[model samples]
Target chain A: MKLRVRHVSRYVFDAPVKRLAQSHRLWPAETQGQSVIQWSVETENAVTGSGFRDGAGDWTQTVTVKGPVSEFTVTAEGLVETSDTSGVLRGHRERVPASAYLTGTRITGLTAELRMAAEAALEGMDAASPLDRAHALARYVSDHVVFAPNRTEPATTAAEALEGGEGVCQDHTHVLIALAHAADIPARYVTGYMLSTEDSQGAEASHAWAELHVHGLGWVGFDAANRCCPNEYYIRLGSGYDASDAAPIRGIVDGATQETLDVSVAVTDSARQSQSQRQQ
Target chain B: MAQADQNFFNEMLNGTDVRAAYENLDRWQANMPSDLRSLKQHEAEQLFRRVGITFAVYGEGGDPERLIPFDMFPRVFTADEWRKLERGIKQRAAALNAFLADVYDGREIIRAGKIPEHIVTRNEAFEKAMVGIRPPMNIWSHIVGIDLVRTGRDQFYVLEDNCRTPSGVSYMLQNREIMMRMFPQLFVENRIAPVDGYASALWRTLASVAPKKCEGEPNIVILTPGQFNSAYYEHSFLADLMGVELVEGQDLFVEGDFCWMKTTEGPQKVDVIYRRIDDAFLDPLCFRPDSMLGIPGLMNVYRSGGVTICSAPGAGVADDKAIYTFVPEMVRFYLGEAPILENVPTYQCAKTDDCKYVLENLEELVVKEVHGSGGYGMLVGPKADKAMIELFRDKIRARPQNYIAQPTLALSTVPTFVEEGIAPRHVDLRPYCLVGEKIELVPGGLTRVALNEGSLVVNSSQGGGVKDTWVLAE
Candidate 1:
């Protein structure tokens, strides 16, 4: 499946910033599951520098706009061809040891609720394999946390999300990651783009999922909010221990008192869109 | 007034005979009158205060403004002894660098089953972002400060290793400077290896590890956390000695491809950074977002070979206490040689059997936190009361993996100037080994003397004082 994605973020500083710098992990991953056709990430009045692939196999670049700038727009548009690999992240280059992902971040830290959920998910299936257990945990999170938007904040912990019982893809991913860790499995958060199928509610501009490191399969993706493992329709970007580390864009501005953010994401199935255009 | 404890090895004497290395020092002390010795001690203190060398070492922060006492007596070592120590220290330093390079890359030591995987991979000091970065010269720790305590005439044990921004090299230099100023005749009478070459050697070592793309005389700077830091004096002192810029986080900014230092002339591109800040505060974009004390995109520049960071991020993993136990193993695995320096027998409280042994013999062992540094969160069993020991026991039990216990070895003593008279006080050695294109160390080190009588901990925060270390010419 070929996917077209356009992600643009606008930032308006209330006061003029002395300097602006941002680190972007917006490039699609080069793996067996995906191939990049064309991609360009650009921001007006910014110089992109120090671009390199990180230890987690994410291509990151630094964007610097030195000035008393009040506003700017960062736009990333890409066409990527992906394959259905049964959610298995194969042939992905990463140097970070699997054990390192077992480390929990502030938002993905294991809480008692996550532990109990993991235990309950695998209660009768004591002999279930690690892959099966991961699936069961993902299912448990999907069934428990109903897909609800604007119900939780970005800084909400997995424990809080579990208690709320209503959150979007980010909360579902955090809770699943926490549960995976409670079961002594290594897992990380992945940030990417998802095509909004008609039936899939709340498929927004961007999507997040949890990736569990299984013994034989390496990393396997599970999107609990969508209640299925990610397939060709998912465009993998990068992964980190939690949302902040895996964020597509992280910025630091010098002496900007207040800033406003505007984000837009449009992901479409290229073949279907082309067919509709032909019909038109 | 001084009791010559026969149980502890006295460096100045060997069974009632003056040691060969200290014979001249003993005669020098004999020739000086008591009042003059006292006056000279006062002068040394005044010199130290005038020089503004009052800050503490590492994270052992007491009163940052208080001056650490300068002992009039010096610790002496013979050429043969220092030669062996140099070899051992260099070997350990090489292995530690090799371990770090491997831990971030192939991890052959872990694959060979020499060290456990979790101990290295799951360590809090291990930076996942640094896993694949190939640093200049493949050296993570440019300056490896190995804490050593001498037990016997030929026996030395490494207490711990400091890989990141090891402090007190300034103390070593200042002590010698003052000692020479006070007693020029002593320098004339006894031939001591000059330690002034340390600044030059350090400069060369740092310059040698500049990024490959850096052309000509690579510009370098010392990145300090600012004036409020406990080790700020050392940062400025090194920068002055090296004739480089002493900069704070704000003084440097990342531009296109390179990090630049703001100067009166213009923006000077930095090729190497001897950063005295912690890794968590080195780059705000890559690390803690709340940290305002770091360059926003310095790590990215480092990753792309625009600049170099001395004692690279994640270098602390090699010096961790739990990882310290495997130094000898690393020596064997990486260098393919026998370890010249022996490690103290340590017991991990995380191991049930070791924990039981440690619990059963609380009074004879020293318990230290695995992650704690600078004399913090440690229990000197012999020095602790019952209540203190009980407190440590519960701490260990609550988090066994967080603690490690070792036998309290009898640290050797040197004749130190005391209120009553010269007395034997426990001392330790921290020799800074430089690694770059080559591995090297100055003959002398910073000798920390426990000023409190009978105390074994040599941290400055805990009644520890400074002494000039001398290596005699053959």
Candidate 2:
């Protein structure tokens, strides 16, 4: 699918936050089930950074601020070319068998849960394509867990939310990630901004979703929050093992000022003409 | 001062350019005592950059290179100075070990009223979970890094005691390797004692405290709180160097008063753990209940003598910045000898008189949190403006017992290579001392350099850099 993305986030503070640095991992990871044919990110008045690695092994950049009242705007226009396939569990697939999730029941770390969940979800999914299983798993998670805002931290796990039955988009994505891993799919957490239909003229708020890697199709995007796949409204910030690893902005400051931050984001449907033309 | 080294200072003052004076062949040679030698300034800088001996400065925002500043010149310690420092470090470590053993077991010092009970009871780091628990070998602090600063000629002072998973040993080892390559000729000529054996010494220290049941070949692992910890590099480096497994908290579990690590092969018994996690995060069952970085009942195994944790839990009792005021006193009381190293004049804010004095002289004294490290909870009175001083005064007044005040000593300086040229920068040393079955101080400790001019703070989180410390045989 070809799509144009517009993401904007503004952070207003009670006091100015100097040395403002941010890292974005939202660019869909290049893998098997998903592929990006052409993508370019443009920034205005803000320094676009790259080539720095944080704790989670993702490339990041430190975006300095003009002042305390700062805004980060990212616009990506791209054609996402995706394909999916499935056959015998070969090579690495053999190691992470479809039965591994059933046998390894106890999932400890963030990555381990994804592995187990993918295996479990993929248990009977031998006949389907990698994207077919991923889509199924994403829908299943949305049906199972109800989305509740401000209920979990960025590091909250899929199992924790599934057991608790409450979480935001972060938890939904993690639960889906776990289920995808159980189905033998490699998935990652993505942080970005969601464009609101009501605010078609602008973006809505910061958002989170998940991407699953199929054997041949590369990495395919799934929004467990909206229970649909990503289209033109999603603006990629960064992706990681979990949400905490890809927070839009995080850094330390001196001079002992109590920090209160307010974030406002906006994304608009840049492909409105194309969709209207198809309707006509 | 009529010292022979004074002439070098005069010659530098006479030079048109201070940068040229440090780099000039004749002046640089003359600055070093005939006995001391090192590489040319440029060569040393190249070696440091190549070795990847760097620290991640916490708040410097963007550039990775801005994290840990590196200098060209290595700090030199004469054989005589090293001997004195080694003895002082060993003595202080021994006294501290004894103090920890007593605090957790007998509370002899408390009984004698040497240290106030309220102070001990009110400490944030003082864990009730550690009470009545005696580790194997009865040693609490198996490893300690005693920070020392030499302000004047051979006058060494104990800055602070780092008994809690003290980092920078990896940097110490890495720095020395770089120093050797940069100043190969100087190293051979000076015959500096190699500190490369620290890993082996550390391994032995941890092994000696291994659980009794697994005597012949005990399984020792280095437990880290995970990669988010600021000291994660040190934890991994030490583990790799010691050839031991580095396990995260989740990788460990307690089964019937025994700790075991979950390895890929199977559940391997962990007899000894060089734990880098803080005491509060060591066990969810015993410490912070919400901490996922800790095993639920790992402390139960340690208390039951089924496992040994190096620099045992609650060893922070002696490391408390308030308690630091009494270290020299503890040394005198326990060892029955005067301290080899002097302590900075410290004032306990909890005391009525000292609090009054600190409140009166808030702008002249450096106030620090009793439990804080990494240059946090510190107010440099001299450098601080009136508002900062007022803010710190209020903090101290609100919680007198949690703070301590000290006279800011002019930390000694060493010639360091900077972008402009070589200039004198304040630096401090932290020598690692191992006390297992025996006490062994690594020949050279990590020399932390304050990169900013006239700055006394040398924490990596701040803009401080590091230099290889050479303990010369001469």
Candidate 3:
């Protein structure tokens, strides 16, 4: 599967910060099943400072901002080629089992309501094969947690939304993890960028989803919020046991007494480029 | 000071061998600050940077490579101080281990009124999930780092205990390596006991706790919370030193009641894991459902004894700041022995009398948030301005259970380097101990120094550096 992804995030500050510095952990190194043919990242209002390999062996890029500017924008575009292992799980799948993956994760202490709800949701899921069960689980979470903007400070969790039935991508991912673990399946969180439709402006947006290890098929990506498997429109940044690990960028800033930020992202797949590239 | 010495420092540029680099220490001593303590500290700083003893400080919006300030000069401890520290640390670790065992199986400590059930229940770290889980070795605080501070020449006090992610051993090893090079004559003459065996000992400890099924050749991995963590470097360093694979939660899974690590080869079975991640972030399925840093089914495998997680999940219950004061009692309760080390007199704000005393002496005590670490939410009343003290008073009044207060002590000082020369700086020691099948203390501990002239805060995040502590040959 070939994926041409453009991710653009714009942070407009309430007040311009003087001397801002940051390290971004966004770029994903090409692995065996995935290849990046072309990729580039550009930032406005920030100068690239240092680049180094971090302790966990991830490549990180540092940026320093000499800013009195009201806004900063980071744009990343890449052409990624991913293998379709719908038939057989290979590559990263070998390390994680695809079958009966949910069995070992215990969800005993979770809210009684959530446990019962998950149990009810997985009534027919166990009978289904691992791949189908994963799909069902994703679908159930998507249905259970409504995708709505949650302006909660920092972020909210799956259980918090279970009572309300609404949350953003993070909630969807968490609920999916809880449900999968309830069934004894191993699930992980993925932070990345998802392509936006034509109506949306800009390049790409930060997105969160869940991945389940399916027996025989390997690790399969599922966007519970979208109620579908990750397609060519998805560009994976990193995978963590949860959402916090795979956060696109995390670091500290100095010389600022306080900081308030507003972020916007957009992901668009252009038909013109697709047709032109197909011709080439 | 020697590194800055014109002739000898230049001479050292000519050679790369460890011995040649330190030969100039005698010549540089004359130009150094009059304070021998400061001179040693300056040398320690240069050595730490050179040898790469670093912690990744993730500034909210800055580059994270700012290494923890390292002091070249060590805080020397006589045999007497060491014996007391060893006894205190061992007692504390053993008691905590026993406490955890009791909490999971017996709950005898709470039931006996030695520690109130309400306090245990109120502690945020106390986990209901861990209620019935007894580990293979009945050990929870497997890798303990007991923080100790010297108030006077011979008066050492227990500052705190870090049973969870107590980092900086890597700094100790690397700092000593650099110090030996910078002062080979002093090091050779003094005959410092090598701390290089810590990794091997840690590995042996982890190996000892491997699940019985995979005893022959257990696959051991060091689990980290990933790169962005402040202690990520330590995790990788320990992994490298122990000759084990460094894994993140996503790199592992649970299946068939077994824990498996994702390896280049395949889904290899993992029998033992020295996880640096906190209990809440170790297994999302077991603790916080929102945590992405933990494997979903890891706790299940642990429950079945399919794998061993050292300093097992939920160990934080014993190390809670509020529980620190009871360590002596815990020692007496579990080991039937008097405490070898004494704790700094701590006042739990949760108590009415202590709260009143703390409120009255808000200007003289050091107040700390029960759950905060690395000096994030600590206030020294005397050092703090009125506004800060008032802020602390308001906070404590609002939530007394979440705070603790202790009288500020003149934390002992060792000479360290400054911009002009050497000066006295407050320092503390945290020695790492490993208990798997047996107890082994790393000869040298991480000696943290407050860089600020008169500051008592010695956390790396608070601008503290570390020194290579040496246990001199007896």
TM-score of chain A of 1: 0.95
Docking class of 1: medium
Query: What is the alpha-carbon lDDT for the whole of candidate 3?
Result: 0.67
Kindly give the stretch of ten consecutive residues in candidate 2 chain B with the minimal lDDT sum. B1-10
Please list the residue runs of candidate 2 whose C-alpha ends up more than 4 Å from where it truly belongs after superposition: A1-280, B1-53, B57-67, B347-405
User: How displaced is residue A168 in candidate 2, in Å?
Assistant: 33
Supply the TM-score for candidate 2: 0.54
TM-score: the better of candidates 1 and 2: 1
Instruction: Write model 1 residue lDDT over A1-280, tens digit each, in one string.
Output: 9999888888999989999999999999889889999999979979878789999999988999987989989999989999999999998998999999887888988777788988998888778888898999999999999999889989999999999999988999999999989988999999998877766744555789999999888999999998999899889999898989899898899894799887888887888772111000
Query: Comparing 1 and 2 by DockQ, which wins?
Result: 1
* Tens digit per residue, CA lDDT, model 2, A102-210: 1111221445545555566567777987668877788777776777666776556678887777777777877876776555456666676555553221122467787
Error of 1 at B80 (Å): 0.7
Candidate 2 at B78: error in angstroms? 0.8
Give per-residue lDDT, candidate 2, residue B27. 48
- How big is the positional error of residue A244 in model 1, measured in Å on the Cα after superposition? 0.7
**Model 1: per-residue Cα lDDT over B1-474, one tens digit each:** 344588888888777788878888888887889899889988988899899999987668889889998998999998999999999999999999999999999989988999999999888899999989999889999999999999998999998999988999999999999999999998999999999999889989999999987999989899999999998999999999999989988999898799988889999899999999999999889999988789999999999999999989999999987798899999999999999999998898989999999999999998988878877999989889999999988888899999888888999999998876678899999999999888989989999999998988788888999999999888
* Model 3: chain B TM-score relative to the native chain B: 0.81
Q: How would the candidate models be sorted by DockQ, starting from the highest?
A: 1, 3, 2
lDDT of each: 0.90, 0.65, 0.67
